[model samples]
Target chain A: MMFYIHKAACISPQQTFGDIDIEQLHVAVDNKLYAIEPKYPHFNGNALRRMSKSTRMGAGAALPLLADNDKPNGIIIGTQVSGMEENGKFLNQIIEYNEDMLTPGSFVQGTPNTISSQIALINNNKNYNLTHVHRGLAFENAALDAAMLVNENPAHTYLLGGVDEISANNYTLDTLGGWFKKEPCPSDGLYNSTTAGSLSGEGATMFTVSGNQAGAIAKLSAITTIHSSDVAVVKERIKNFISKELPDGKKIDLLLTGENGDARVFPFYQACEEILDDQTAIARFKHMSGEYPTASSFALWLACNFVGGILNIPRHMIKRHGDLKSLKNILVYNTHKVGQHGCMLVNVA
Target chain B: MDRIVVTGIGVISAIGHSVNENHAALVMGKTGIIKGGGNFPSRYSGLLPFGEVLVSTDELKTKLNVTQPGVTRTTLLALHAFKEAIADAGLSPDELSAHDTALVGATTVGGMCLTDELYANTHGDTENVEYVRSFDYASVNLFIQNRYNITGVVNTMNTACSSSANAIMYGCRLIKNGLASRVIVGGADSLAKFTVNGFNALRILSDEACTPFDQNRKGLNLGEGAAFLVLEKESDATGKKNYACVSGYGNANDAYHPSSLSPEGDGPYLAMKSALESAGLNPADIDFINAHGTGTENNDEVESRAMLNLFGTLPNFASTKGFTGHTLGAASAIEAVYSVLNIDRQELYPNLNFSEPIADIRLQPVMDHRSAAITHVMSNSFGFGGNCTSLVFSKP
Candidate 1:
């Protein structure tokens, strides 16, 4: 079953939230990338005043997909760290007060499903709502779920997205754990570095999906996850998916690979590269968006924009340029924790 | 669409370590909730009651032969239940490692079971990074994926208390969609200062054992556990011992409140109504209901009202949370196992710690273990985010 991405929006560290101007991509702060946000004036209420950075970004991204006051049949979200900033605030409150004087304010909004609930609350929608929290497969799973749900009732629409945040507590611990580069790593030279750690970043990307193809930017052709640490096993999975999805030997015009600049885990990207023909253009987003669990969502946003003919492959994103004929099909390939790999294909609607 | 059936089930909870053990305890009307939780040294250690698992982390690690680093208590409990489930299904190694075999796990806290260590790290009081790998909620299922080498579309659901019920629903969808022939789905959550303090701050955690659906019910008792059910296509599960058929599922959002259901119980009513529609059954077809019944002031009344609104009269309904406490992410899965057991055995387990009927609803629950001509069983789980889900399991 095929589902169309009718309307898509993204709030990221880049200028992609609007019709992105490639010249004004966001730069990192000490290798920590943060999403550029808006005033979110539409969210006006006391309840929304308590929205966290992640929830605000999520709702902001998803709000544009829906017409004013129009609610989808479901809102399924995916995130590795939603409401984490609230969590840290609550925990710090407990520690500072010695677990004595703490309110449920922050704790109440700190669940992994808080983003989905906040969106539902704002719209007053009471249809199916779910949140998937996997390492990197979060968005892919949510997308597939949306597809299945839409297939169940093609007349119904669904809103699902991936949103995550990089809190100081998490970033500090992650940096201490060697997940981020020790020194400043700018977006320009992200993949060129020969370092053990990858750059850290966070953002939110959402879409209003439906079985109908009207006013659609792109069709989500396929989405899957390959969970393994072995390069050979991962390579086999990618190779099989490539062959199956592109059975007629049609080359992907643009392949957005989630290649974080970590030299230690570069071989997995190489494995993905091995499956594609040299004629296929290869571009990685981590160089522009940085690396997070749901970075592939940014890749999806890119794929939709490309197929929608919003822009050409930006010079900054071009790693291995090929004949830029037309944007027919694009693939998003990303790895998480250097073990879990995720892939999604977007075709022109 | 293919029919999804439960081939095997496994669970590890505060009441027992395995499915059979839990069933035995249910038959004996034994409760796992204690006056104080001994697992953690939180401020509420002795002040509030908890359904803490009886087993120790080290003992569980040794028992499960899990030597991996960064494996949190949540993962340990999940692995313990996962082992029992696959074994009960009599799945061979080849079948487990097959491409069509998938796993969907649920958890609210993955590696944050060490809430104190996380706090210590945040304050620069400790230089330890061992808990870093477990910080992502996906770590719970990541450990499982690595252990079982499950390559199929593995995902984790974290919709608060309704997490595993959604996972179970997602598993059935996978089978029906021809994505996978089998999916192992469940959830795990262990008591930690993180959750304990969070709930304590909410002021909804009870000081004594929870009494669900009672007039004087104080609140819910926090619990810990894990449960896994092997959901497979009916053709593939034909030769296996089928426990129950995953007939229908429905998920809805309350939207009225983040942590409280609407006074009208719109979410709960829609969920149950959609589930019955999905199952192609009428209200009379549902023989029993494993209600969400958290014993919280808002939940019990609203859930009861929803039942009355939908069925006009209650079925054989009970909240097993009185026995296992609210396990958060794991509650729905554990209760799902109990629901399937209710149909498979043609018997209903009693709801513990119940005395008087709810004042407003004036409805009584199944208070004694009794045999009945059970057929279809409905299981409900509502989460903190107003995410409500209902699942219907029927005789296979």
Candidate 2:
């Protein structure tokens, strides 16, 4: 049931695209992190003008991973709040102008699947297209969908991705909802904070996946999502997942935990750590990418880079750096406040 | 892959409230398109006809015994259908709360149906703060999952009009992949100012009742409702009363326009062809097609071309949108129930309000209700952003 990752591209707050060195990670300013903007001069001017930030980031991240000669068999995207800026504008116009003289541009671009459709139209890919918006489980669901596609139809390669954007109004709303910390903290300080909320961040990560293993960057082993708020139940589930994936009692090389510095949710990560072997090196990424619903996609991207030997582990993000001879297996665990727990396993290709 | 079968179905629309009622209305050629009522207040309220659910929010609350504040109409409609589906399937509370039972729901307008309330609340109007948590796209599904204590793989999809079709497809995949034994797949969407104004801006709302496949057809009338079907593996549904088997399904994007399909209907053609291939059946095996005919000029013409391209000679085809209007996310699920009904009852419901077919294609739909031995039925659902999905249901 393993699928190969042919290519991986990410447009995030870090220096992921056209990277020089992963060691020199980009830093956020004023407790906010935005994806590195992409420039697309070749796109049609009219279409480009109508594309929202989510669409731009999605298309930009996908352009590099897609081969010019081969069209994907399908395009699946996972997003938390797709086109929030456009949707907010649409709502604002309805309220401000009393629903009169409202434009359709924002409303048209505000759907969650607009990113996938835009990418399909740009690439002329008339394949299976879908979008999932299930909070933190969105990207994992997309990945699972890609895996299912590959399993069902092994002849075609698929494009899977996660895209989200941070807007001022959305940030203000999240602040009021106690989703963002009041004080500014450096990206490295996120894992250690005892704050009520974590810093807000957004990005888009795209991967080319298929059954073909030739020249794969990494291999996706397993993905599982559990909907539970009980810490004990989640802990047991994680234990069963690890044993099921590694039935031979093999040690996990590295673990990536989505500890976003929210004090209320950190215990779930701690419970995950309790099940890991003492030698399993634990790493954190929300410190670098900040906290978004699809932050796990960023973690997957980082794990692929690490397994591919393109990135080195940062000392500050590790809780208990385990000793391993080589990078063989990596596990990513993430949880959302809405009771979605997801675990993804990846290995060196 | 294991055979997937539908064990139960539930539906609530402008035309009817349950499967029996909707079937009766369909057989009688009843139309639910009427002048606007309910809480939807718009500038074009009286001028434009909409397929509004006859029940008011208060009435729905009283009927369902809903006591929770800030519950949107979208969730209420979903709960109504979901409860019916589960009950019809004879699922107990313990079985529903099992870890192997999954729930996949879809909705374009979740809590956003309360457009004014959300807009006011987001603007520092703290009086309706309770509504803030209900604004997410997963609110309806979450509410249903929590109510039924569904602990399995719960996911929400939002792919515009094709949302529920994709949900059903996803549920099938989960069972085929051995991830779950049973999955409830459906979608719900209530009428909202957000959608009304959005469609108005697109100029697709019809002032009169829609006339699908007719030469002088006006645009579509927006509708609201919810529908769901309980899906389980054939082995697990041994003793259950199976409505129909979900033999095959396919999804594709048009890659053409955001709001309109290509004149050639490439996406629709490929989706239908793929579904046939997945079902291991030729085009001739299909007894009927439930077209995604939104009663719009662009959709009808393009879909007709697509059907012509695939079947060469079209089969018995009709668009139920003429009866219930376009229910957006809920359209495909509702149509899926209709497809099952067609199979189980061996019936063909007429395409209401159709005088003549499109001049170019010149293919006329069934003009009257009739009984026929049907083997397989194909249901098509196309959405904004060119998302097209086709599902095949076979007699069980």
Candidate 3:
């Protein structure tokens, strides 16, 4: 196996294992959904006091939840807005200081890779580390890299993850760009909604992926990202890939969709719905994650949990078909309204 | 094991645009470091010299032959260097796409130069909403992918100064593992007040010319540039021109400081050791070393000590920071290009302005440029967040 996710942690708009269970997640009618306020001091207190909002929460998720003896292979983080919150603060200081002087702390932490680096600092991990940023495919690209690392060198137990937060200023910019939906999907049924924008959610999810299969959560089967002008081509590619990989139509057991109540990008999700029959139970995660470039990471985390039989589909998600049996194969498809698409496959033990 | 070889190299740094220009300047001990040109308030900047590019944006655009790139100066530099590298490899557009080619780019500034300018102009005016779209690091790589029509494993790695080294290392792995037949790997960075002020706030800017491994070394001088290399698998490289063969590489985090390196140089020490081990060679096999040697008070001394510990006696080693200054994200890739040049020309560039030694062990670098029968060169690039990467290239 190239990659095996041993443990996964996430902090999103939903209750992501810190404050409460999945049933207690917040319900929002507006497309904007913020992560439940994370308790940073629970992981690293001093860092909690020093770090900015995104950095603290991002670093917190990378901390191991299960294993305490085994050191992680390394840390890899994916982010679209690295330290934009701190960057905005630094810019504000520059303006307030009249170009005379400003605190370098915010500027130092403002880099896109600062979160990953800070995680390394906290964990004291000197192993192979990387930070990848590609708008919609940021986490997929990062996940793919982590998988390759485990494949190339089995000595590594990688932490592959992604984090994205909505800054006040940048969120407004997204609002102007039509990325954030005006109204959020109801908590009772997220997938049934007909809305213009996605629930704006922010989250950070990390998994300990290793090549060793002993006590592994799930095995990464394959991953492919395409930037195409036509959705039909994407469907064709997916069909062709599945045909070549599976001869007897082994069939995916679960299909994870990144439908965030946005009607425009639902066609890709519909394509997934059309390709697979009732054997594959369809699920949507954008209701919990909201919509971010790397929000597919959240879907991937949920997929792995579902495959491991550790998580049951939340009532808010769209469940098109099939009862949760021995979950085996999961295929996730995510696309932004502006045409960034990602597809990934996860296989359970 | 399949070997990965550098078949072509291109760079646009402070010294020159093309490989030949930079090589000539290095041999002649020329410094690209110059005083600021009133781009900002000079008083606040301490009159520190920087390695600003000589070519204009329009000139670079014309050279790259891009009509509507919709990118900033950083992407233009990357495109120019990438085209030269591809052409130098003698690969046509059809060959590039036919072969499994991956594009790995690194940049710290991204499109901040243009975005900053636009943001400065549009302080509060929401009329120009286009600038907001430019606030991303993926745009540069996406543009390159589109321009070259490369369709495999296109990604970007940003690890501060060691960004491109990370990119190059990833490309090397791609070829070694039979993932890609060929890979274009390197880094790009452009001048921007955002990065400059960021570094300045850390108080690491040097007023005088940077002096690597010197007792009185001050700090690094910021620069802007880009460089790239076409790496092909050994099996696929038959009958094809080879710039230099990649022998080995290693990446280690200091786990010491977020910005500063470990006082003991543990990261560099492990990185160099791992690289040598990966190459299946000893430190004695290295003919020359391109030290990270950023000339900062902390870096130069620590790197020198790391050298002394690794080789016992330093070989022909020098810091090209004097010629190109420190190009941040582009430093490692630019130095990779320099390594290929060294192996091909059998030359060792001088470490300009290195009059005195810093470390008590007193490792002396090749103070003046010299030409020899170069066989292998080891290059080091360490960056913020304790990222340390080392690359070893050999004559093809």
Candidate 4:
């Protein structure tokens, strides 16, 4: 069963949140890109004081999507890593103070579900809430859950999203673990790098999804993930998925590939490219959003608005061309370092 | 919709290391709470009681024949329970590696159980850098997936105490949606200084054994363990030993506070009502309820109020936290296994250390072990962040 995206919001490294304009893409000065945060005046001072960066970003992105006095029936969030900064602070205290005088603020705020729960608490929404924490399949899992929920209960709306944060400690750990590029590179030049790691980025994207399509920007047809390292297996799975999803011979107009600058997994993108139709426009988004687990969420937000004619596709990210007649179906494919691939199909509403 | 049934079960807690052992301990009304004694050293060693598994890390490694370096205690405990579940289901390694077999595991402290080592490594101590990559919540499931060659959809969930219940619910959804034919669902967590200290700071750690539903219940005793259940479609489990059928499940958030439930128990009421609706049954159809009674003053009273609001006369309900303490993420899955056991054995386990009921509700829990024909059992799990989940298990 398909679910519709009613409204979408994002707080990414680019100016993609309110009234997004692709012409004003924010460029990163260093290897890391930070989300452009927005002011939140609705939260009380004491409540705002206790929230971590991720919580604030998530709430900031989600609260605006809801109309006045709107309460969603559920809140589902997907986060690769949550509260890293708070966790780091707590761990530092444990080491510096010998675990005796440890404070509870950081420890309490460091849980991964705090983002989703905080959104629910702020909205006074007591509904079906859950958080998925898979490496790269996090957002896809959340979307899939939302789809199932709407399919089961057609009357209820849901707040579905993904959030991830990058702290100094997290960045250093990623660098040490070979997850970030050694030399600094411009954000727009991400796809041109001949390096092993991709630029690190963080963002939070939330959407109001339901069966109702009165104000929907896009229709989510399918969302799935396959776990395989072999390019041949992944290619076959994609072919099968396309065949199953597009049984009426409906061709895809655009394809969004999760091709970061990393050369290690470029072959997976190549496999996907080899199977796509020649007329399909192939585009990349990681260069602007940077590469992080759940970055596909930002890509989805961009696709929804781009199809809705509210945002334009940056010329540098596009590789192939499709005639702009009607601008219908778009597909997104993303993968993680450990061989988890996800695919999402969104169509113009 | 395809009917999902539990084909195999495995568990390892402070009370026992296997299903039969745990069931025996439950039938005998044996509590596992004790004054701390385990591999980890804590400042509250002599003062606080905890439900600690009685095995050392080295001993677990040796018994499991684990040769991989830097395997966290969380992974070891999960592997131990997963191996037993697969064996109980009579699934060969080849069957387990099938592309249609999905694995869904939950945990709050995956590799973070090695708190001191993680602290040292992240703080630039550099002595235990090998555990750097194993600190994420997915590390334990990834280790299991790679070790067992589970090629299908694998995911990790961390919803605090209600984690594994949600995992089980997700696995059932996968099967019903034809995403998988069989799924292994459960969770694992290990005792660590991080959790102990975190709970201590919240002032919810009871100094003595927890007494659920008691008038003077102080708080909860933190515990750690793992449990797994193999769920297969009814058509696929024709020849297998079916424990019970997963009839219904629901999840909701309180949206009240980060660590406390609302006095009205709105989330709990909605979750229970949704579960009953999904099961196509009324409140009168439920024979027993495995309450989410953490022995905390707020939880027991609020849960009682929710139950009273739903069923004017409560069922024969009790909290096994007195036996196993609060296992956090593992509590739901462990309670699920106990619920299945109650159906399979047609027995009711007693609620230990409950001498007096609360003053307001004045409701007494099941205090005597007895044999009865229980057709349906409902298990509840509520956690931090106001997440609440309920699952109904019916006799097959």
In lDDT terms, which candidate is top?
A: 2
Residue B162 Cα positional deviation in candidate 3, in Å, after optimal superposition: 0.4
Off by over 4 Å in 4: A322-326, B125-127
Better of 1 and 2 by DockQ: 1
Candidate 2 lDDT, B108-149, residue by residue in tens: 988888777767766777555777777777878888888888
User: Per-model TM-score of chain A alone?
Assistant: 0.96, 0.96, 0.91, 0.97
Q: Residue A168: error of model 2 in Å?
A: 3.3
Lowest-sum lDDT 10-residue window in model 4 chain B: B119-128
TM-score of each: 0.98, 0.97, 0.94, 0.96
Show the lowest summed lDDT stretch of 10 residues, model 1 chain B. Answer: B124-133
Name the top TM-score candidate. 1
lDDT string for model 1 (B205-266, tens) is: 88888999999999999999999999888887768898899999989999988788999999
| CAPRI accuracy category, model 4 | medium
Q: Which regions of candidate 3 deviate over 4 angstroms?
A: A28-30, A42-46, A95-98, A182-197, A247-249, A322-326, A336-339, B37-46, B62-70, B115-124
At residue B293, candidate 4 shows an lDDT of 93
C-alpha RMSD for every candidate: 1.4, 1.6, 2.6, 1.8
Candidate with more favorable, higher TM-score: 1 or 2: 1
lDDT of 1 by residue, A1-349 (tens): 5689888899988887766676556778788778888777787777567888889899899887866777999999989868888989987887788788788888878888989998898889999999988968888888889989888888888997988888878787777777789877777778789987888888999988898888888998887788778899889988888788764856788788988888868899998888877878998788666777778888898888899887677778888988767778898899976887888888998
lDDT over C-alpha atoms for residue B218 of model 3: 89
Q: Provide backbone clash counts, one per model.
A: 0, 0, 7, 0
Clash count (model 3, backbone only): 7
Candidate lDDT (C-alpha), each: 0.87, 0.88, 0.78, 0.87
